[model samples]
Target: MEEEVNNELPLPDIEVNSDVPRGPFALLNRYGNKLKRLSSKGGENSSKSQLLSAMTIMNMAEKVLSQSIHEKRGDVSNLVEAFGSDYADYLKRVVWLLDASEKLTKRQYDEAEELLVLALSGSLEGHPIETVLTFYGKYLQEKIEVERGRIDLERKVEHVDIEQAVMDLKVGVVECEQKLPYSQISNFTGVQTILDSVAAAERIHFIDFGPKFGSYWILVMDALARQGVKQLKISAVFSATDSVEETGNLLTSFAESMNLPFVFKILHLDTWEFKKDHLQLEAGETVAVFMKFCLMPLSDQPNGIGALLRGIKDLNPLILIVIDVEADINALDFAHRFKEALLLTCALFDSLEACLGRGNHYRKIVEKVHFQEVICNGILSEDGGFKRCFKIDLWRKYFAEFGLVEMELSQPSMHQARLMVKGSPSWSCCTLKMNGKSMIIGWNGIPIQFVSAWKFHYPVSPAIDLFILH
Candidate 1:
């Protein structure tokens, strides 16, 4: 499959299809009309459902146009003509990504490279979203190189080091409030459900696998703070030594501020050494295990993921909540990973335009750089622990293997999640789904991330949410 990718295939010769799309004109119009309606309509603002409709239409249009962008060819007019310069710039980048992703799947390396170059040409240097695309471009181009026999498939990022990832979790600090994951977590009903469940229990032993900055704890603490918990004890797994003290301090301060009875521990361990016993748990206590944005690192370790699951089974936590980006980044096949990476990142990048003003310099940087690093790591690099992520289905399989069954998230949880989404900016478009025992969050219809809650024994009916442990 990698061989199909032409490391240096030029853009398909511009050939105007007798049936060109007015080329992205439909989506352009849909976005503009919706924007105008939402901004112009006073008091009686457009509904979220309507906003979602616009976003879904725009996304679908892009996907359709992606497949036939080559057909639009030279006759393509200025995007600035239809939409203003701002929207035009966004469309250009979207087209470039769609073009590149579509071409990459078709193994047109040179053509994809041209689009990538075009996207990279301008002041994309400082943008996080652009940085993400850069990583995607790098990974895809590297795949072409490896297939061309220029480099080995096992190349790793030379200096893969941990940064202050948890710094953003600081309450009231709006530095990275526009982050997509925050929305996913806050809007994730499973989180609220788990917290509410534990709040009633006598004791809570919460184990986090890879606690990045203990932000999950902060979020959890925030929720607990709101409702007031009886007693809660948390065990955080801090991978970076530098973050250990800070995470502890912040969590301690947060618990005190919230006035919740909280005691916690931070376990610092590296990937190769993750052990089943490492996840400390009391034999008799209501326990919950959390792995939010942390599992991907250990995924590449041989037999490591299996051992981690086995350890989880031994603990027998009443509830296991796993939340991560919804993509099959672990797939070895280049084309499959590329498509997943492209679609997922596009959805995320598109979603952020809500809180941040369109063409907001800060947002562009966050999307280009920070999130880019994440997407690139997941989809591109074959080694150096850059293996990206997997969706909820795979996680369900793992949990099932450990004799755990999927528990339907409570309707209350779903309602909470729904409220959170409704509470966000009216201009933002996020869709939530609850089918059987699964909870998913998506940008438009494309599932960007998902959350799954599981347990040893699930009641046959979804109505049986509350029960005694014994």
Candidate 2:
């Protein structure tokens, strides 16, 4: 018989292994800040080194419990103190044992192990090693417990510092929820509320200003199709910051798949920049500009509202859908300004509100991905703050100034829930009574005017008509 030739390729060497492997729970540069509080001249040592040392010692002790260090467990007799008598002495002992483990002779390893166990068991009172070693001890116990139920087969349970582990888990769950396949759920449910309100309008065009990935727009288009929206031409202008080709392609594919009559195109400029462009005025295209979570980045940019109104007029769309985060305690704070600014527009004006809530839900959600730095640090005016709530008022005002009025929606989008996603549509609106009388209430708890849609009519007459009418 011929010998079989082995064909499987060897796996690459994995350097990160047990004894406190670097992972989500591993020490980070944040620990350096804690260490800085302990030393007067902490500048001498880089924070990275201190963090590395702390993580390594904790990791080693977590894996091999019986190992020892040359230095006595939790003994700080010869070391220089830091912080106070209690905190300084304890930290020294922890650092000394960690240092001893670095050389890692048999006795030193054993001693280090003893110190960690003693610290976790609370036998070594008054030592701050408890705080540092706690993660390792918990991980060690979890590993032991996990292995007991699965003796026949090897099983490994991932563990990190409790806080980091919790954060990671929350992020994973949220991402999974947002990433559900479209086929799994009918798309109509998502945009049904918006469609119903705008159904009476003469011409309707969906305009997504910042169409990141275009998933939301696709869903909205699908929902419109379900509502018997056959001859709709959508002229979307996406900010260039996100992947343009990806968004354009996805929108095209979604439009094609649904066999919808829509001309979808992504813009190559920022939403703020789009406002500056001299767009050619078109007749009867009910331009509903959907800018969900995008406006926050340009909150401080001068003439942001004016730019939006100008863009709407240039398009001469019958309706302009203005959606964004209602980030304020007072709904009037947002609505009053938004309505005022939008009224300046010569085109039609109609507004609606949805998903209105208290604290800035949109900003809080974006902060998770380090995008907060952009809003807080980048968009902030030289004065370090601006009337964030002003955008809401401007939109509301613009609606009133234009001929179109608010068309109340029976079912509006949930404000806080949408804030969970890091995309546009993450906004809130104050609920108000939509009688012909436009009353701005300082208002108590009961939701009154919760209008988020701005639906208006642009006359099919030439641009001269607009100028003459104004």
Best by TM-score: 1
Cα-based lDDT at residue 360, candidate 2? 20
RMSD of each: 13.8, 25.2
lDDT of 2 at 394: 47
The digit string of per-residue lDDT tens for model 1 on 231-317 reads 677876666665666666778898998887888776677544555577555555788877666566666554566556656666767
lDDT, each prediction: 0.54, 0.35
TM-scores of the candidates are 0.67, 0.40
Whole-structure CA lDDT of model 2: 0.35
Q: Give the C-alpha miss distance for residue 253 in model 1, angstroms.
A: 3.8
Task: After the best TM-score superposition of candidate 2, give how far the Cα of residue 450 lies from its true spot, in angstroms.
Answer: 8.4
TM-score, cand. 1: 0.67
Q: Show where candidate 2 strays beyond 4 Å.
A: 1-190, 197-204, 211-213, 226-230, 275-284, 328-366, 374-405, 410-451, 456-470
